[model samples]
Target: MPKQPDPARRSERSRQAILDATRELVSEVGYAKVSIEAIAARAGVGKQTIYRWWRSKGAVVFDSFLALSDAGEGDLALPDTGDIEADLKAVMRATVAEFADPAFSAPIRALNMEIIGDPGLAAQYLEKLAGPLDEAKKARLRSAQQAGQIAPDADLDLALELLYAPLYQRWLLRSGPLTPEYADALVDLTLKALRPSARP
Candidate 1:
């Protein structure tokens, strides 16, 4: 008799297949046009399999994006180097590179537009995607504050906005190029603003 496959392995394979199918479909057809049926057919899985793991088409697409980011370079993590500025610049540069990738840009732009138009979807996106990244950055900022790299009273939330908003705005509006140099500049400006005051 043939040996049976491991259930956990089979489950992971199905999950990865669904995510891969979603990513390819989103890139080809855009997020709004991709459906659960299409993903199920593409992944060679039943519709029930997709529904078993994800609540909706949007959730699957978000997970696909997350998987892509993780496969690319574990995008959810921020460096915890003692040099806070260097750590932040590293993260920003990676973000700029991802934003510039055509495969990522198109689908992410579609998702952003979708979230903007739907409050419920926007909340979901924030919770699943942006919220984790925000928490990671805030944790890094708190670490820096404890180390005296940043002012103790600095608002980490606002600091995060200052660090990321310029690059995001440029990507969203096509107002300027999203480049490593731009990312570095943003990091420098933010660090300057957050740096602890010099003792007289």
Candidate 2:
């Protein structure tokens, strides 16, 4: 007979199955329709098994997001080429493509709208997603500052806004497409506009 699986291995398999079920359900039905019972049924696991791991469906959704984010096919990190303009363009192009992907668009759009409508949930979402993304952008701006490519007096906070407001306006508001040329143009214009005068 085949040897019995270890307890840890079994636990790991169960967790992965639950997460996978959550992703599939979220993709099929919007977050509003995804439920713990549905996930348990889809995963082929007992409802109690899911309850043993997650207290609510939101936790399961968050776990699935973390899994998808870690896959690294998305715009998770900016390239550090010591040239801020090129790095920004590269990251922005990647962001546009990732945001445009069908697999990510619907769930993300729904999640963003839900977060905006619910204040309590918005706070949680900001802490989980927006806050980290902003901090990472600030770090990139600071790196450019140290390199003297951007102004020494550059406000990382404001610069962060300048860097993303156009893109966010496009992504969330659908005012325009975040094309490669648009991204490159934004970076070029930003460098020319924000750079310290040569006299200074």
Candidate 3:
């Protein structure tokens, strides 16, 4: 008799297919129009199968984005080039580029919408995604503090908000073009605000 296929492997493939299909649909059609039924059809899985794995359309969509992040396959860490300013500039510019890319931006827009409406999904997003990424960035800021580059007493959380929030707002609102120059300016302005306080 032929050897049977591994059930665990088969299940993993199905799960990934579901996530890939979700990402594709969300990109092709805006998040508001995507349906679980459509995702099931695209993934070649039954609606019951998706339901068994995910509680709602939002949950599935969230996981699909999470899967993209998880593709990094290791603990998250920002670059440490000893110069906090340069490192931050590089990171911000990369973020701007991502927001400008349709492949990345589309799914990210979908994830943002899903999180906004579902409190539970929002919490999951914080715990699973944003919280960890924030911690990684904070680690760099903490290193800067030790180097006397940033005020030791600076609130790292606020420092991060100052650095990133405007870029995010502009992207979300389509208020302005996201460009390399814009990213650099945000970094310069935030670093000025975070500079070590002068001694009296």
lDDT of each: 0.85, 0.75, 0.86
| Position 95, candidate 2: lDDT | 70
Question: Model 2: what TM-score?
Answer: 0.74
Ranking by TM-score: 1, 3, 2
Worst 10 residues of 3 by lDDT: 66-75
Report residue 97 deviation for candidate 1 (angstroms). Answer: 1.1
Record all residue pairs in model 3 with backbone atoms less than 3 Å apart, i.e. clashing. none
lDDT of 2 by residue, 48-137 (tens): 998887777776676666566543243555678898888988877777777777687666777767677879767766665566677777
The digit string of per-residue lDDT tens for model 1 on 3-86 reads: 766877798899999998998887777766888999999999999999999899878887887776743345555778798988
Q: Which is superior by lDDT, 2 or 3?
A: 3
Which is the leading candidate under TM-score? Answer: 1
Worst 10 residues of 2 by lDDT: 68-77
Off by over 4 Å in 3: 1-16, 25-60, 67-71
lDDT measured at residue 121 in model 3 versus the true structure, 0 to 100: 69
The TM-score of predicted model 1 comes to 0.86
Query: 155, model 1: CA deviation in Å?
Result: 1.4
Q: Give lDDT: candidate 1, residue 190.
A: 94
